[model samples]
Target: MTAVWRKSPQDFGDALNIRETVFVKEQGFANEFDETDKTCDHLILYDGEKAVGCARIFPDGEAGWHIGRVAVLPEYRGKGLGARLLCEAEKRVLELGGKMLCLSAQMQAEGFYKKLGYRTVSEPYLDEHCPHVRMEKIL
Candidate 1:
């Protein structure tokens, strides 16, 4: 079975480990760690005792929240964990009185996000040396 939970301050190490493995070690993203992490809300997914997915949501300086740094360990892809993480993030946003949620999705994952009801709001662009597009969904 799998479970998702909001990470406590002390639980950050597990979340960071997953992100570092997926975003930096596997995907070659430079500066994968950022200052914003200290302020953003983080979610982590676990399959039994193993942490397999992670994502973060931060206030967008507006009425909605921005979701980013979503990552699922390589072995855990194709198992719907990404969708679970996103859904959990959206739930948190609504609980926090947010009206919508947005994310900068990598080009390759655009279809996946679309399948979850997110609509593209921007043209494709480069970020972290990869193609990305802005997408959003109303909660």
Candidate 2:
């Protein structure tokens, strides 16, 4: 399947909906929806006409981009959509002249982030009731 990436408000909303469903509803992250969404650059991965995955990146105020709210529909997992979405987000950040990327990855998905070159920088901590580790990558 061909994956197309785009930056658009509506597409960003679609991405947020998927992330809210997976992280907030399914995972019980009561505050998963945060103010960051309002200021972040959102990247959406579409397969044909379907939005399969998405990620959001924001300027961290410390000379880096903070990546968050990455998600893929359950049926779309295991197909590398997540990776594709993340790569697109990274590309977008680089295009904007960002050289650092940071994220707080759910502990369960730490390995996934590591595979993508993210290094854990902090011990696991609680975020919205879920354990997470701060990770970063120098682009």
Clashing residue pairs in candidate 2 (N, C-alpha, C atoms within 3 angstroms): none
TM-score of 2: 0.89
Model 2: per-residue lDDT, tens digit, 1-139? 4544445555467777787778877787777666766667777777787777778888886669998888888888998888887788788789989999999899999999999999999998987678999999999
Clash number by candidate, in order: 0, 0
Q: Which residue runs of candidate 2 sit more than 4 Å off their true CA positions?
A: 1-11
- Full-model lDDT, candidate 2: 0.81
Please report, in order, the local distance difference test score of every candidate based on alpha carbons.
0.88, 0.81
TM-score of each: 0.93, 0.89
- Candidate 1, which ten residues in sequence have the lowest lDDT sum? 1-10
**Which candidate number has the best lDDT?**
1
Kindly report which residue stretches of model 1 are placed more than 4 angstroms away from their true locations once superposed. Answer: 1-9
